[model samples]
Structures are given as C-alpha cells and as structure tokens.
Target: MLRTSLTFILLTIIFSSQKPKKNGVKDLFKESFYIGVAVNGQQVSGKEAGALPLIEEHFNSLSPENGLKWSLVHPKPEVYSFDFGDAYVALGEKMDAFTIGHCLVWHQQVPNWVFENESGEPLDKDKLLARMEDHIQTVAGRYKGKIDGWDVVNEVFNEDGTFRESKWYQIAGKDFIKNAFRKAYEVDPAAELYYNDYNVWKASKRAGILKLAKEMKAEGIRVDAIGMQGHYTLGGPSLDEIEKGIIEIAEAGFKVVITELDVDVLPRPNNSEGADLNINFANSPEYNPFVNGISPEAEAKLAQRYADLFQLFQKHKDKITRVTLWGLHDGKSWLNNFPVRGRTNYPLLFDRDLKLKEDVFAKLKVVSKQ
Candidate 1:
C-alpha cells in the first residue's frame, strides 16, 4: 500500500506541473472580461462554415452586424422582421454567450420614410416622438430577456463633439437621447443600456459623451455603460490614449465596452482618418499597396498592436465589461471594401482560412501572462 501511494503522488505532481494549453481569446480574458465578436447573417445561419466554429470556440458574446439595425429590423411603418435577429439570439443562447443589440437609434442606416408622413412632409415633434417610443418598445420588448444589452443610441455626435444635425436632433431635440433610453428601460429594465459612438479617444468626443452621460444621470436616466467604438489603426491611438480614454469613462462611473474593434492594416486613401465608412474613392495602386497580402512585417506589427491594447484591457478589466471584435475574420471584415473596393485588408485575428494568424495569439498569450 505504501509503494502504490508513493507512485500516485509522484504522478499527480508531474501532471500538475505541466503548462495548460492555450485555447481561445475568451480563455485568455476569462477572468478579465468577456471576449465578443460581431456576426453577420451568413455566420449566424452557418453559411460561413469555418467562422461559427471559431465563434463557438473563442467568443463568449455576440453582436449582430447590421442585423438589428433600425432599417433592417423594423423597415416599414407596420412591419418588423425577427428572422435574422431571432437567429442571432438563438445562436447566442446555444453558445451561452452574452448577446448585445448593436443600436436602437442612429442617423445612419435608417429609412427616409421614418422621417416623412403620407404627404412626404417631415414628422413634427409629437409624431416623431411617438414613432420613436413605439419602435423602441416593440423591438426591445421582443427580445427583452434574451438580449443582455443595447447600444441605445449611436454616433449622435460628430468628431468635434457637436451633436450631428441628424433628423432625430431636428425633430426631437437633444432630449431624443434621454427619451430613447427611457423607452428602452421601460420595456426591458433588466437589459443594460449603453450610449455607443466612435472617435471617443479624441478629447472633444470624449467630453461630449461625458456630457451626455452627466445629463442622463441628472435626469435619472438609465445609462449603464459607455461604448467606445474601437475602430483602430496599426499606428495611431497610442497605448497611453487607450488607457486614458478607458479610465476617463470608468471614472465617470460607467462601465466601458470596447465595441466594434478591428485594426486596419492597409494604407488609407485619405491618410488623415481611420475607417471612415463614408469615404469612397477610386481604387488605385497608391491605396492598395498590399494587393497580394500584408507583408509578414506588417502582420507582426498587427499582432504586437493587439497584444499592447489587450495588455491595457487586462489592466482595466474591472471597468470593462466586454471587448468585441468587429468581425470574425479578414475576409468578412468591412475594411476590405470600405473607402476603396477590391483592396485586401488584414484586420482580424483570424486569416482567410479561419485559422489563427501567424504567432498572433502566441504573442498575445505571452502578454496576457504578464
């Protein structure tokens, strides 16, 4: 009996000393925060064969890419399409992932009919306000318990921090933001409500969001989180800026979410900006320098960039609830066709084959350990 016990004790010590195998992004940040990814219809419906497996393996949260937008979900005055959105919720449930609604109100991707009446006249204050309430209640109510959170309003302010002259502002005034959150809470008080926007690292935009959050709080609005759209580039938004921006929002007493994250690795047609979806230019050799592929040097830089940003994320994990990649893989990223068409941009953790990029996760794993 003593001989057998000694052998078992030795085996247990040997097994315990072995290093644990690294698996997925979610695993790397398991204690820090949930790792999330946005999924299009193809990915949700299993048409993107390889992506769903990666999503199931790595991601613990899912956001619908254009699936839950106003025009796509509630297009006509009397209609609501739950097909795609429902599928997304179902998939999230199956994976036991946190499902988030991209947005409830935004200037872009909304139908013109929303702002017009039968005579094509713009909606007055009362009519527009009613329309907003009905839409939020119905859409948010449909998946009340299923969806965990929402981008209650998106991109309402420009880069300079002034409110955009969107029709929502024109019709409902600034109270449109407050009203949207109120209605969402009324229908689904359990769901987390967030004000999401881009360019939040810039001082002006960050101030604008803080101002909005302040107003909402004073009025007893339910602003649960502030989402900074992490539409980053390879070289900009230094680690200091990312840390500062996240700390700024967390300091405002709001949980921060890194939403819509993707690193663009190509030369911009307009060098002054990053991921301006509005910009459309003629394709040229100047813009599409990496027609064949991103050089290995650029790939290494991309991995290092992610490692550095994730290091910051881990450091601030207490305030950050989730970190979501914009898309599943390079082939599916909107960066491929935006600004200039037919340009191959490597902007995601996974390559076209749905495999891990060269040494990307390995480098990230080392950072996570640190």
Candidate 2:
C-alpha cells in the first residue's frame, strides 16, 4: 500500500508541473507594473477581431499606434476625426485597461497650416501659441476624464542634448514645451502628462530631459513621467546604459515609463539609432534578408534580449510604472518599413499570425519570477 501511494503522488506532481499557467503576461506582472500593447485602428474597429482577445488576455493598458496622433486625429486645422480614437478608448474601457493618449505635440505628422497662416506665412509667437492652446484644449478636453495619461510632447530634444529646431521651438521657443504641459494640465489636470522621446538612453539626452523635468517641477507644471522610447536594436544600447537611464530618471522624482518598447532584430545602416521618422535608407536586398522569417538562432537571440529587458524592468519595478510594447504583433510593427523600407523585421513579442512567440513569452515569464 505504501509503495502504490508513493507512485501515485509522484505522478500527480509531474502532471501538476506540466500544466499551463492560467495567468497571461499582464497577470504575471500585475503586482510589479502594467503590461501594455499598442492597438492599431483595425483592432479598435473590430476589423482585426483576433487581436481583441489576445490584447485583453495579456495586456492591462492600451495605447493607440496612430489614432491619436496630430496628423490623423486632427489632420487639417478645420478637421478633427475621432472614429479610431473613440473606438480605442472604448476598447480600453471594455477591458478595464489603462488608456493612454499618444501625443498632443510633435514635430512630424503635423499639418503645415498649424505653423503657417492662410497665405502660408509663419504664425508669430503669440498666434502660434494660441493655435497650440486651441489644439490642446479641443482634443484633450474631448477625452479629459477618459484617458489615464497623455504623451503630451514627443521627441522635442535631439540626441546631443539640444532642443530640436521644430516650428514649435522656432516660433514659440521652449515655452511651447512648458505651455504644452501647462495647457494639457489645465484641460485635464487628472490625466498624467509625459515627455516622450527616442534615444533617451544616451547620457546627454537623458540629462537634458531630466533638467527639463526639474525646471517644470520648479515652475509648478504637472509633468508626471518621462517616457523612454525603447526602439532598441539587438546589438546596441548596452543593458547598463538602459538601466542607468531608468535609475537617474526615478531619482529625479519622475516616474519612469518604458514606452514604445520593441527589439529590432535586423541590421541597420551606420549611425541609425533613434526613431526619427525622417530618417530613411534605400531598400536593398542586404537589408531585407529575412524575407520569409527569422531563423531559429535569431529567434533565440530575440527571446534572450527580451528576457534581459524584462529582468531589468522587474528589478526596477519600484521605480518603473509601465512597460508598453510598440505593436500588437510583428505584422503591425513599424520597424518592418522603417530605416530601410520593405525589410522584414521581427521586433515584437508576437508573430505575424497574432500568436505569441512561445520562446520569448516563456523567457519573460521566467525573468519576471526572478
């Protein structure tokens, strides 16, 4: 009888160990921080029906890929389209997920009329500031209590720690940034406002952002967090550099959000690092080598890269509030056409079929536990 009981007990243990985990990625990191994914228009509009289930299962926060951008949302000065934006917010509400507004001001994708008059002359400082205020009030006010946060300003600083010479800067100077935060706060004081940018891991850019955050705090502006766009490549931006940025930003009394997180497992031209929309390289056969799919070896490397990133995030969970993947799946990733157009890139956690990359998912789960 004792021998039979021991055999049954051992069998039960083995079966239990092999059972699949009921928790998804969000549940795994629920106590640590929010796991988020960017949803495109199709998913929000129910065209990509498969994505809803996957998004609801794994993520606790939602950010629109382009639904809320200035170009799409308010393409022309007299036009404002909220079809996708409304649906996106509704989906977030349905899932009880944290909803994020992508941006209120950016250098790219903005209409030229925003910076110019009816006859194509540039608006003066006061007029331009007025237009900015109007844009903020109208769009932000439309979703005041709905959106949990807004990336109020994006990519305003260059990699060398200097401000970009965008029309906003040229016309209104740095006050445009300050006014953006202030206007956003005035419109919806409850929503968290963030300054988001790519290549933030660079030491100089990090310093510049922190300095701006401090100045805003001193002026009583409500800047809630700093978003480090994790548009990283596999072989660059050493883990140490990323961790340092996280630590310093948190030490500066601002929450750290790993916004737009993705690992580009493709080669790039020399000196191509940040997510500047203007930077484009000629498409060549060399850049599009993975036309079919990545090899097993490349897949393993990608998984390991994500493992390391999640491990770092988990270690600094006390300081980091959210980690958001840039797209729902590899198919929807902007990297596919970025830097070199027509390149097949594998940069997201999910495959083209909307299925989770099991290897990468497993690594993330293990690292979260550690």
Candidate 3:
C-alpha cells in the first residue's frame, strides 16, 4: 500500500510540472468569451474529418452556415425540412457547444412564395405578418431549449443606414424586425435573440443598428446581442473602427458578437467590399493575382491583422460574448468565390490542408499572456 501511494504521488508531481499544451483558441479564451466557427452540412454530418477535430478543439460555439435558412429548410408554406438542421443541433448538443441558429428573417435566401400570393402578387401587411410569425414560431419553437441563440433578423439595412426596401419592409415596414424578435422570444424565451448585420462598423450603419437595438429595448423585445459581421480586409476599416463599434454597442446595453470574421488578403475591385457576394466581374488576371498562393509577407500581414483584432477583443472581453470565424478553413471560405470567382483566398486561421497557421495562434497566445 505504501509503495503504491508513493508511486502515484511521484507520477502526479511529474505530470503537474510539465507545461500544458495549448490545444486551440478555446483554450486560450476559455474564461473570456466563446470561440465559434460556422459549420456546413458536411461538417455536421460527420464528414470533413480534417476540419472536425480542429473545430472541436478550437470552438465552443457552432453556427449553421446555411442549414437553418428559410429557402433550404422550408421550401413550401406548409412543409418544413429539418434534416440538416437537426443533425447540426445534435452535433452541438453532443459536443456540449453553444448552438446558434443563423437567421430567422432575411431579405435573401427566402422563397418567392413567402412574399407572393397564389397569383404571384405581393402579399399585404396582414398576410406578411402572419407568414413571418408562423416561420419564427415554428422554427424557434422546434429547437427552443437546444439552440442557445438566434440571429432573428439579418442584413435588412443598406450601407447608408437606410432600411433596405425589401419585400418585408415594403409590406410590414420596420415592424418586420420588431415582430421577428417578438415571435422568436414568445416561442423560446430562453434563447438569445440577435439582430445581425454586416459592415456595421460604418458610422451611418452603426447609428442605424443602435437605433434598432434601442427600439427593441424600448419596445420590450428580447434583443440580447448585436452580431457585427466582421468580414474585414487587411488594411482598411482600421482597428480603431472595430474597437469603437464594439464599445459603442456594449455601452448601449447590449452584448456584442464579432460574427462572421475573416480578413481578406486579396486585392479588391475598385468598389468591392470583402464580403460582397453579389459583385461578380468576369475573371481576370488582375483580380486573381494570388491564384497560386499568398506571399509570405501577405501571410504575415494576415496573421498580424488577426492578432490586432483579438487583442481588442480580449481587452473588451467583458462586453463581448463570442467571436465566430466565418468558416473553419481557407479552402472553404466564401471569400474565394465572392467579388471574383475562383481566386485562391487565404483568409482563415487554418490553411487549405486544415492545419493551424501556427504564427496566428502564436500571436494570440502572446496577446493572452500580456
């Protein structure tokens, strides 16, 4: 008995003396905010083995990239498909990760039948409100306790901060945004409801978002956080702008989520933003400069960009609740095909082969230590 006790104590001391391995981003920011990744159907279905381990190690929250959207999950009015969404929610549950439903209301990816009557004419306000309520209630109710949060509305405001005159707004005005949140909250009071948008760092857009957040609060809607889709580029939208936006949102009494974050390292067209999926010019050598690969210097700049943003995130960790990478690996990032088609864009922390860019994590670890 005495020999056994002495051997166990010796082993424990040796193990405790060894430095712990830094597994992934989750380990680095475990105490601060949830590190998250947007997942596709393949990752949710147990395929993409290479990316799965990295996701499990690095991220504590999962957002379905397209699984929960209206067109994909619910094509017809009375019919709903939950196959991919169910698998996604199940994966998050099994991993004990926070599951985020991508969106409940959006101007895009919605079926034509949503805003049209049987004769293809636009529906009136009453009809549109009913449809919106039904969709939110059914979907939010399905995964009520399982899903941690929902992006109740997405990208409804234009770059100039005016409400995008979409079918929703044309019919219901800003009440669409209000009713989406109210319905989602009514169905699942426990779930965190968010209004998510891209390019929210712009001064005009920031004002519009703060107005929406304030309106939600004033109206007693359960608006928990604002998802600033941080699809940034390497040199523009300076770090100061990013920090200022986060602080402003938090000061307005809402948690901030750095959602859909990726730093595009490629050259852009004259009027193109990094995440503008609609700007498709014919393929050209000038647009696709880095077809072969990103240069070493360019790679260094990307790493530094991530480090700078993360340092800001860590500094305001209290007001921030999550930081979600738009995608897991460079090979799968939508930036490759957006604004220009078939260009090799290295925008994620993981390489095309699903290997961690060591320097990126190294920079973050340095920040964490400081």
Worst 10 residues of 3 by lDDT: 271-280
- Regions of model 3 farther than 4 Å from truth: 1-21
* For every candidate, C-alpha RMSD to the true structure in Å: 5.0, 5.8, 3.5
The alpha-carbon lDDT assigned to residue 78 of candidate 1 equals: 97
TM-score of each: 0.93, 0.94, 0.93
Q: Top lDDT: which candidate number?
A: 2
lDDT of 2 by residue, 132-212 (tens): 889999999999889999999999998889999999999998999999999999999999999999988999998988898
Please provide, for model 3 over 1-370, each residue's C-alpha lDDT reduced to its tens digit, 9 standing for 90 to 100. Answer: 9999999999999999999866788888888899999999888887887777788889999999988999998899899999998898998998899889999999889999999899999999989999989998888889989999999999888888899888899899999899888899899999998999988888788898889889889988889999999888888788888888898998999999988999889878885763545668767888777888888999899999999999989999999999999999999898888777888899999999898999999998888765
lDDT of 3: 0.89
* Full ranking by TM-score: 2, 3, 1
- Could you tell me the lDDT of residue 357 within candidate 1? 80
Candidate 2 lDDT: 0.91
TM-score of 3: 0.93
> What are the clashing pairs of model 1?
none
